[model samples]
Target: MKIKQLKVRNFRLLDNMVLNIEEDITLIVGKNNTGKTSMFEAINIFVKTQEISFEDFSQSTYFIFNRLLRLINQVDFNSISERRKEIVEKVIQNQMPKVQLFIEVEYDVTNDSLINLSEFITDLDENRNDATILISYESNNSLSLLFSFLNREKQEISLIRWLKDNIKAFYQTKCFAVDKDSDFKKDIDLSFKSKIEKIVSFEDIKASRTLDDTKSDKNKTLATGFSHYYRERDQTKEDIKKLEETLTNVSIVLKGEYEKVLKDVISDLNNFGVSTPITIPQIEIDSEFNSESVIKNNIKYYYKHESINLPESYNGLGYSNLIFMVLELTSFIERFKNSSEEKKSEFLTILIEEPEAHMHPQMQQVFIKQITKKINKAREEGINIQLIITTHSSHIIAEAGIDLDKGFDRIRYFNKIDGRLEISDFNNFRHKESDKETFRFLKQYLNLHKCDIFFADKVIMVEGVTEKMLLPIMINNVANSLNNEYISILEVGGAYTQKFKELLHFIKVKTLIITDIDSVDGNGEECKTDFANAETCNSTLKDWIPKKNTIDELINCNEEEKFDTEFIRVAFQIAEHSNTYVGRSLEESIINKNLIFFKSEYTKDAINKKVKSLFTLINQHSSENLLIKTPWDLRPKSSSSKTNFSFDLMTFDEKETGLNWEVPLYIKEGLEWLAGICMVNISEK
Candidate 1:
């Protein structure tokens, strides 16, 4: 059965969530602590209720959920004032921690007329529901986009069409699968126990009843002829030792004799100007060796074997996990109603949590490739493969390339910023995000494509869209005066400057930063000045730097609400401070006046019209798509603090233009002084 939709309410961290899930592979990812795990828990909780309780596996259900899953955010103590809010909301709104899931499984109707046309609303148990309705979105006005193969007609299509064409999905989780090994123990009951007990007896009875049981036939033959062989067999182990001694004797004689013959053969081949053959069938063993024996007389020519080392503790608790993915997959396998190619198309929803972990990078790729091959095999043999997995591995991410621009039908992105989840249909998305860094890297390094500087080489780092929209025009006029290359200046939803670390390695350049110091992390003072420095600072890699301040230091604003709102967080602080560093005037001009915006005059003629302008002064250049994502703390509509920022203002040009910055100024006097030192490297090649 295919899952059509999912609805979750006040279940742990998920607070009234609903998603329209497709039946095929669905991928989910987000930044840390942004409810990705909570969403999976909501799904597991619903599916898990139909199975056995946690006490059968762990000590208690709550213990597994709290200690194992760690679903609930632990508290030193929760006062009534805090906990009472939930109780009050229930009385007023009648809300409950209702974990609802909708799975629309499609099976062929042998008789279509038998379908209950009288509204299938009664399918769910109404007594348990707080409320129910189809979770449809208002923004899905592009009816043709949502459904497949429509001829401009918004009419409802057949179930056969939607099932065959439009089903999209994926299943993956992380962090919570640590205890998956024992999950199935809860589901094993009396019937499960009884089945196992009968298995041995049933196998023995079948073996005894069969006339052509193979072992019986072999036993009858052995009964008549085998006794005659035992006298030789009893003495053969000693024979093996004797043979080794003889083979050693023969080897010493052969080494002395064959040296002359082998030299003669090589001399003949070389004199004839001919290459020698690879295999020599007739080799001189020794005059002491017997050739006409049943086995090779020379024991040296036989087996030279060594034992392979294997891991001990085969059933140890490594692959055995808290989530029990393989065990859950067992249910999906058993749910197969038929083996027919068409009938068993939808059998299981496979959820994976970083299957790449504990595996080598090469092994991770191989494991995924092999499993996907298995999935494809299952699909052909009448089982639908629905995969949900998450990963920080770029090797894993490239498996599902963002071919959105190439008109591929499948793509989506889930980003976790602070405590919020931002999901978008990547197939329909158009934006410059940090993932583009990784995309640019892979395209060049992995795909071996030439870099397009508009997409790569040019590192654009600003705090928000405010700077993103404004800088290009300003750079066009001012950059050359200062010798800063007027590259594409864009914002990667940030103040997290460190995200650019890996990207710097790929493209071979450090990014220029532009940001406001945050309120907490950017706060100043030396050695024991900050709270993190009190204990955690000495324990971290960042200990060399005395203080890690909140970026609230850079902004010039005085308003406290600046921290709570977007667009204003950086610029608002700058405006209210009345201080002159990146002042309130420019801040108010961009934020309040809406003086900044990019209304895409986005034709290539418009983009490349300015694109060539960047090349007009360049000489040598190369670029790579590095898939390392520059993660950030500052996100749109988030109240979380912004930690850092970067401004990727310049880049190297290919020397074909005579604008290569790495060249010495003596030969290229036409180049301005500002064009010096922009290249990240100067190789001796």
Candidate 2:
């Protein structure tokens, strides 16, 4: 039987969160401290590999002293008469609020043994082949006893004794597995021990950070199959002696061989010195090769070079971790295979944290794609193994994205909502079945470099490479900070920017789209005359995003001329410095504001020469009195690009010139809006 779902309450960060586990493998991913580790801890505690500690209590849950203090703060002791106020204070100080957890677990009941063992089946969907069990565990504090102690008027009753008694009353967790049909209060005798022990077992392999050699490392005793070997065989006096003798014989043989070579050297040295003879020192051997030392001395890691052994530690960290992981995984399988039949527990949940710890990106992808199959093949003894991996690696997530056909729904996304942890299924982002097609498209498009958008606090969707290169610099200037907030500027292009709408919406990150109006004629060429929307601007946007009713409202607010906010979180605005005229592209919109800085820096520069020529042509062509109001106006009709222009602006020596490069009005406004919204979104939690 596999675990289907977990519902936890009053746990750390998981004040109320439900996690749905996929059958074969479930990948849990999120930013750090969003409760990825807490989710695992809740499950681990429920399954009892680990028990709940005092610190595991949710931040919302108050302890005895804190609860009493809150109550004291709420009361007006001065309002009552002096003696009565003292009694009111005593009453408030005497009691505390209790912290309780109501955890519900559901399992897919394929095994007959589990069905027979479970006395509390909350749900049994015959069509789905599943059974669910609800468990309620709580920390108890006796309020009646506290009231009794306060009501008694004894002369010289120690407050310390009363506090100690109340504190002890709340220290223990009372657990009960709840049955659906029966009264929950009456079913206090229910325990999960008989049910869980018969059906499931848990194994957690935390993120491995080995500081020393694996052979002697206590943290990874299974690295060389030493743990498995020890488990299978018992060591006695004879075993110890044999291990010691093995070491002794190897030492003696090596020492003899060394002495043969040293014999000639000593004689030659004695002749040269004309004094006492020098010789190689005798090799030392321990009297007893203990279990710990035996493995360290005998199980040496080596690489073969010309049939010679080289130390494995001599390799890179990536290689060492790869080898260590392989060995540990093999040992885990062997241990599962060799389990006795009488135990009646055959299921294992393997919790792996950051399996891509030391591996390169390619190896990280390979690990995610192949590790599950390897685990399944290794568990040939018919032991059921479920894999739950937590990772921050983009390569691994990409591999998972590619495997949508198999189990994309298995990926669990964890995020915090207003300081409370929320776990959502991967399918929650899929608005419809057609979104799976978009998923395929996105999976192909998001490579290692682009996939970093998934981790950013906020995102800005731009039309081309120019915006991607220049926007971050503009944002740093507007926000007046560098690297304080991570912003991903993706060049999704105008035509396909809508592809990421649902994804950005579901991730709940604020994103701004700085798109051009793209005013086009009937032939779909750039509009040469007056700007009017027929095949471009709001009409194209409306056609691209028909479902968003909000953009229709933005059009009512005159979107034909300038960019405007479609919504608070996701905004779409035309790239323009002024409403009087529009730029066809991002570079065109801001070029005028940049001319003064560029001209002063280098007049003889080749790029500036091209810019000057383009400006002269624009001035000659314009019949109207246009003063080159924006950068887009001076953009050349030829293949002259803005990438180099932006590069020059970014790399300009401000300290040498003692002048700051001015950011264009439109660009600055868009960046500031992005920064403001992102800051607000982040501050929400």
Candidate 3:
């Protein structure tokens, strides 16, 4: 049994979000400030409702009353009497906004370990074995009559309260059907509260909580568990009484040994024939023995390595924090086991935030994997367990990967869209029954660059390594727009660029795809083809974007024209240029546009001896033959080799040609397009 779904409203950035839980391990991942933490907090608030603090409220909630005050004052509140202002202020204080969290859980009805929750389980809808718990923190509204005389304020308060309360009805949960305009409000009945208490063992391991302060205090660590296990579980009071008696007897015996050791030390000193016998001061040892004093005063945890023993706090933060997490996990599991079958619950949910904190990259990767495996092993031993991890570590996600067979999704993505928190589930991103191997490759590719896709304000996907290496320089020097945009140039190549189509759309970043126009001169009939597979224009780029949506005609005639044009017109320019490449690849296009630079930079043998003009050059060599390296060829792997060759030409242009190399028309047009779109968005903002 596990949490089947979660719906949250007015909780920080997550104004309204519904998340489906289909895996044993659910990874919440996204860029920072995208409400990943907010989602986690919402779950925490639901699971630990009695433990709510003022800080748990959303940032927007705190400003709600203040904003209302300003609005009221600006309109007509200044004309009100001083007594009216005080009443308005008092009412405002008590009418601050609220946050709510709703959770849908799937549980096994036959699990005897959860007998304490049997009543609530029976109360669930007869058609389904699921339950929905709506936990909310709302302001007390017992003072509604005070606003009646100021009738406008009454309407405002009533509407705001209705908006806050009725929005819960908008969420559809597993247990109940919700209409958008439904007015049902869930009060925590005894059965519902019992289910919340017994059905799930939800524990939150916050990132901010560290071992530094409590490492030396062994009693604080053990007291809760000790009290719960020995005192809470044992209905018979005789067990604690037996424990007290055993401790008292043990203390007396231990004190005798201590006295014997002191006497022996004094005797040894006298036998050594010292001039004066050293007087030893006797210290009082507490005779009264209780669990608190015994554990707190006598027991202390220390880090042991071979013959070395150091206090727990003496270790480095990474080691200590890992140990602390392990201790917490073990204690949680043991507490679940310690309870009697009738009182215990079978389902446990653990929420971990930023598990990579205080750990190195390698440790971060290994830690989560090991912990997840252990958690699954625990699940196999009869406890139904689910782990929720919120992380920014690509290493952790890569290690976890996407394994539907083992119930691991490819980490949900969260981001802010239109100033609201929106999440795209990994399960929805791809089909669950699809080939897992391709998904593995995608994760590996994304993990290689540490998922830089999250950092870009806009993204440019390119087919080759050369494009990835040189696009930044072109954007900076030729386009002069590097500072204006934060763009990620991903070298996913043409074949796999489609893998990121859904991802880019989810992040909602502007994306430009640049690929080579691998044209084939088939019997002098020009047909565009894919570079890798040699299929006639069957590229991932084609699959991702429609030809109709793109420019109808190629802008290839102006091989040297600059595009100081409208953003929409220039936005996808190079894709159109590819349509006009009769038989030229990106490398061929570069050489054709800058023949003088290529000819002067490379050896004379590298160029076709018979070729003199750009027109003759295209006619003489097919795209494939132009780049095929022979012994006489000066460049290695012509397509990729052009990157270094062009780089050299750009670097030493003044020395060789006594002028800076002119930016290629296609490259300039593409960069300008990307920059223009970014500039337009910035200006609009």
Candidate 4:
């Protein structure tokens, strides 16, 4: 049996959250303060402690209680009718805020043993194999008693303060077994604790581990683990006998040495105590040893490299942390294996928080890659172990791969939207039948690139290396507010930018896609921007945003039509210089906006040869007007290196090289919009 899902209500930031568990490993990833720790604590509270407090309640739930209090305070109880009084009492009973957890377990009826899960199953259907357990902390006090307490203290203290102080007096925790199909709940007696323990065993390795290297340290070490393992495992009679004999012989030798060392003192004490015929006093020395004590206090772990031997503390923290985690995991698995036959749990859950705390990227990748092998090794001992890892490491995520059936589907993304926790399961990311190849390519690309867009506040998908290298400088110049936020700039090019549409929507991050117009004429031949009957060859333009193919339609499209959603906006080349002409690509757009800068004699040797040649051609064509009738006529050809052109721009400075230039109008507008949205989001959070 395995835990299929977990639902939590009114618990801290996880006001109403449902988490679907993977069969073997579930990876929970997110930014800070998004309730990753709260989910861990919720499981710890319900399964291990069963303790609830006022601080555990969500802030939203607290406001709910305050509203209920106001409703009660406004009513005049003495003048109320019988029906009205009943309704008020019923509302008070039903509307009280409570923290709850629902654990759903799935079992195999035909092949698996039901010894641990049989008690929780109430359905008689032969096809059913699922059971749910509801654990809740609710008020147990009567309304009359609560009202009396409130009246006595209403004027003495504020209602919220009073409630905080008296919460434990009225609240209690209860457990029930719920039927899967009928939704009928049966109260499991106190024995429910044992039953639940037998169904699942939980172990948490918290982030803040004590890894002190001093001699006085009392943390878990390999030496201590050995003692624990020895105690838990059965020892043969022959081994016990041999150990006892060795200890006895050592004790005898130590006793003789102690007597010889204290011989002078013993004689003086005997002489001082003896008096004539009275019994003489004797000073005796004894040496005794307990095997367990000797092993626990005397043993130490060491690392041997060639001819050198050093203590475990002598190693660096990265290796120490890795070794410590392996030891802890091994101990947990061994403890499960040694449990009694009838009381053994069906599944062992190990929750590890931030395993990359003290490790480098390579070590983190190794840990993620090896975890599966370790778990499978444990299964060889007839133990079922389910692992949940909460991490902020992109390296680990990248190494896990993004295959729908085996990789990225195991990821659970936790995000906060409008001050409420939201969870997006990658397993639910889907695509149409025609987009299967696109999905496959995306998975491969993400795995190879190690993209951290999953954790960014906003995303900018650019067309090429030119945009990737120069966009930062543009943002700093025009949209400085975005510089302070976590923005991921990805160079997905125009062809594949639309492929990430579903993923961006799934994570719900604000996105700005910057691409080119790629104008073409009839017969699908590339043409200038002002050519007759021009149409866009860019897939993102024709199929994604605006959904227009004609150049005239696209140029006249309103700003609102460019937005795919409130969170996504697409920007491309547009008309410039009071709508005199339009540019087709980024290079052409740049030259159009900074015509004088390119025409200056100072920039003749500072720019790429192909770009300089294009500028010369445009200047030659427009000698009289100094403004080309068609800007796209002098566009750079496909042979020109855009990356080298961008590199040339990188070598100049506004103050030193007289290379001041403005961002294209479309990109600037998109950046400003993204900055405003992100700033508002940050303020709300």
Candidate 5:
């Protein structure tokens, strides 16, 4: 049996969120305040405490309460007509706010223990194997009392304040079994508490782990953990007898030492009037050894380094955290296995929050890799252990490979869209077999270079080494605000940028794809932008964005056509200098925009001689009578390296050379739009 999904309603920011669980491991990732922690808290509340506080209610729930209060305040029960009063009462009852957790479980009836799951299965169909258990925290027979209180306090106190103060008293937690096939619900009795525990065992290792280095702290090392484990673990009769016998001998020797140490105290006590003639008070010490107490207080865990032994705290936090998680996981699994057959849970879910805490990137990667192996081993032992990890670490995400059967299907992206939590299941991101090669390339690319896009606020997909090296500078010059935002700039060339279209759309991050026009002539031969019958061969421009063929149409395409979706826009080489000239690529586009800068003395000395001569020739001619139609064709073959040209530009400092250049017009416009959109999004939030 496994938890297929969890639906949380009216719980903090997770107003109506559904998390689809993977069979083994589910990785939840997102930016801050997107309800990753709140989701965990809701589950923790339901599984452990069942104590729902007023603060736990979502803002939407408060709105419901406010509307209900106004309805009650406006009505007059004494003077209202029966029909009107009935309508108002029904609305109030229906609109009462509640926080609910729905746990959907899937099982194979042939293999699973129906004796354990029978109470929660309401479905009558033999073919169906899914069931839902709804644990709801809602008002219990307190509607009338709540209405009366609201009416009495309507003038004196705020409704929100009143609700906050008295909500727990009126509300209670209830569990119901729901049929998967028919959506029918059956109320489980009070024994539902025990039944829920037997179905799933939930544990969490929160981000704020206690890793105190102080010797006085009880939970300072794995030795302390062992004490708790020893208490819970069953011991053999022979082992118990041996421990008791050794402890008894030690206690006897300790008693003799204690008597000698307290000799003066014994004499003083005897001198006092505390002793009677009939029964003289004995001044002897009695010492006893308790195994649990001795284990808990006396054992200390140490790390041996070379010839020296150090305490566990002596290790770095990264190592300490890794060790701590291993110990906790082992303990959880052992405890589950140690439980009696009747009480043991069918599945164990371990939710670890930010396991990358205090760890370096490589260590984080190794920890995830090793932990996954450990979880797989536990599953091999016939224990259904589902590991859910919430992380902000790209290293861990990258190390968790994106194979469909592995990490890719298990990743759940949590995004906050328009004041609501949205979950995107990567498992649902399907691809055609024809696109299998593209998917493989994308997987490798992300693993090697761009996994950070998962956590970025915005993405900029640029065309090759030149754009990758120069985009940061261009962004700083034009869209300075982007420097402060989490922006991931990926170098996926024009030919392949279209491959990321589906993924970018799925993530829904505001993205700007800066690519080239890659103009070609009728025979599919590379051509200048202004060549007759010139068309773009770039896949992104022709097939994905703008969807234009001719250079004239692409260059004249309106800004609105550039937007593929609300979150994605494309930009390419366009007309510059009042539509006089058009560049076919980024290198030509740069020279066209900064002709005078390239013609300057400093640029001539800084650039390759052959490139400088070509730029000088282009600058000397008029736009209409230029000998070379584009800088792309005029450049010497020896100076054809775009990377070297970019490097030359990097050497020219505006502060030192007193010369400045601008980013191409198309890129500037796209970046400004991206910045504007990000600002609008921030303001809306």
Candidate 6:
């Protein structure tokens, strides 16, 4: 049964709170002292006492009062001469806080029905009112009919006979009832001697303990003896079964890691130097089970070696908090298999607290991957498990996208608004969650060059930040200070967009790409080039070039190859023609000084000179035309000249500059100009 809704009135830190739970795994996240745990306690009490009346849940009326007394911190009840007065004061003062629990459960009436055999017995209650509401055919539920109250009949009756035979209350809570003489606390304890007598397994185990009183004696008796062989065989079989169980669990965890959180988790791990090769060696999982089953209510556990050996409290609270996680999951799997189609229980709900404590950044991410993997696995298996977790893991929060509401069923946060427990759904476009700040910063500033002054309309996705920051400006100023039309220099987050841009483009977001002139492994880093400089580089047969940063160092190398490299030449040229330098060093101050020099008589001369310098030093030197063709919709770079270059930017203006101004820097006036008139398109029938 799925939880439709929950309400708590004066329960723990809760003061009349209600939450409508979604059918999917709903994560309940909040900080300390915010009533997250209290909600779970309310559910537990609600389920255990569902059949009882709301008034009977109070502390004053019956044996249920004992629980209330204990809650008031009263332990020993010894020398109290004023018992009745104290009890009255306690009852009036505490009063169990008046808890009312409501549950809406829909049962499958096609199979078994809830039979309250209690109703048939008439002698016990002459008043004949229903002490409980039990449904037979549940879909169209109606409260069971009641008269007044059941009273004992002077004559033998059906109630007496039935109570003597067929009914057994497996578990029950106490309630006050008016009786023939005095109120009674319904006694439910029964001796289990009959049932326990036939259970010989524990007795046999005890006997075996004696026969094996001395391990040495048992060993002697079993060695090369009939007993030894059988005992050894039993152990071998048990070990084999244990091994198989480990293998099965391994497959489950691995499938979750690889199939569910694959992309995100793998990418995060890459930052920690964990790659395919090292990952291969670490796949050996050391698992342990709670091999003991003393009361037969034993917990079956299988833990990873890293988790077991961890100084858990100190190192990874995320992993330790996860201990109960697998336990709850294993229990749910077992319960689902044994549940009747008609008698399903909502006990499958999982409540986790602070799944993000003390974990290293990478582990925080890894934990989310692991958890989502489990969620996916359960969903695929058709198990109706509702997961409610509280996390302090920022990585967990950040990785959850701002538009997470689309991907996730629901995402809510708990914070106090006017001194009350308040929750608000995300304002996705605002990107204000505690964890998404970095994501917004990167997606906004880093990916989309959002500077205040001198921003460009066109963006070129490049490999690194230095490339991202300097590429567009350098290209404009160095390539002849012309195409400064809202240029945005974007770092693709990586070389591969993972085909995510298919959506961005569908929205008509335009971007130019200037990759390593070598395919990346694919963080957008090109393979090492043999060329000494951009001049000698043959990027025609390669996908990457030396990074501009590395190129600067190479350009500054020993004067034996004295030459003005792109940066150097660009710096010196701008310096040569500037009125007042803008940078700290003359080298840096050059760019802002002279846009006129590059725009005028010197544009061709400067371009040809840089081109020759680039050609000379590239080991497999690429010609000028080839290098320029890639980032632009220009020539086939493999050709010898600029003969086939399309739309030469030698005279391209801001309007014709191939830049995207969708966000951060540019307004879309330039882009919408090409959308043509909307005059023809009409709303469809």
lDDT of 6 at 30: 48
Please give the CA lDDT of all the candidate structures: 0.32, 0.57, 0.56, 0.78, 0.80, 0.35
The superposed Cα distance between candidate 1 and the true structure at residue 217, in angstroms, equals: 39
State which candidate, 1 or 3, has the greater TM-score: 3
Ranking by TM-score: 5, 4, 2, 3, 1, 6
Residue-wise C-alpha lDDT for candidate 4, range 1-685, written one tens digit per residue: 7889989999999999999998888888876788988888998998786588888988887677777777887888899999998999888877888898889998888767887787788788888789899888888853753575567745777656777778888888888888756759888786666789889998888998667565545553656656655555444558866886898899999999999999998888788746567767576889997676666677776789789887766666777677777767777887788778876888899999989888998998888778878898887766778898888787877876354567478889998887988899977876624477877877777777735777777889988888888888889878998888888888887888888888877788888999988889898987777889899999999998879999888888887788876778888888775555677888788767776676554433455332332244333444444344444554455534566557656666567545677788888888998898333222110
Please give the RMSD to the true structure for each candidate, in Å. 27.4, 9.6, 10.8, 5.7, 5.2, 26.7
Candidate 5, 7-119: lDDT as tens digits = 99999998999999988878898777899999899989987865888999999887788777677777778998999877877777767988999999999877788777788
Q: Total backbone clashes of model 4?
A: 0
Model 1 Cα lDDT, one tens digit per residue, 1-685: 3344444444443444444444455544433343445556545544433321211121121232223112112322245465664544333222111233333333333322212211222233323211122211111112222223233244586432432333222111111111112231121222322222121111000101111113223222121112222222323367656865776787688877777668787565545633555543443334454322313221111112357432221211222221123323333444342333333322356655545444455555555555556566666776555665544444444444323343211223343333334454433423225466544433444322211211221334455654554444334433444224434343544334333333333323223334433322223332211224222211111211112223223222232322212111112123212223221222222222211111111113334443332211221111121112111101222222111111211232223223312211111121221233332222221
Poorest stretch of ten by lDDT in candidate 1: 199-208
Best by lDDT: 5
Error at 613, model 1, angstroms: 40
Q: Is candidate 2 or candidate 5 better by TM-score?
A: 5
Question: Per-residue lDDT for 220 in model 3?
Answer: 40
TM-score of each: 0.33, 0.72, 0.63, 0.83, 0.86, 0.31
**Which stretches in model 1 have alpha-carbon errors above 4 Å?**
20-23, 50-97, 104-309, 312-346, 401-418, 430-685
Q: Please, what are the lDDT tens digits per residue for candidate 2 over residues 1-685?
A: 6666666766677777777776667888776678777766776666664555556657665455455544555666557688876676556533433334343334455544555435545445465444445444443434334445556477366443454444444455444555434554324343555455556666666785563444434443233545444443434448856866787887668776766767776665556634447554544323333554557445664667787875654556666666566555655655565666665464666787878887898888777667766766745656677788888777877776436475346667776656767566766655546676666667667743566565566677777766777776777677655257666677787767777766665665556677654555766676522444434444325544322223224333332223222322333433234343444555554554545543332233445442332233333434232354444445644434466555655675576555466555555655676666333322220
Q: List the residue pairs that clash in candidate 3.
A: none
Better of 1 and 2 by TM-score: 2
Candidate 3 lowest-lDDT run of ten:
562-571
Number of colliding residue pairs in model 6: 37
In candidate 3, stretches whose alpha carbon ends up further than 4 angstroms from where it belongs are: 49-97, 112-125, 142-186, 189-195, 209-317, 340-343, 404-410, 430-458, 471-489, 502-510, 523-543, 546-552, 556-640, 646-685
For model 6, how does the per-residue alpha-carbon lDDT over 293-396 read when each residue is reduced to its tens digit? 21122222223466464221232334433443443344445545454544443235565555555457777667666766776787677655566655544455
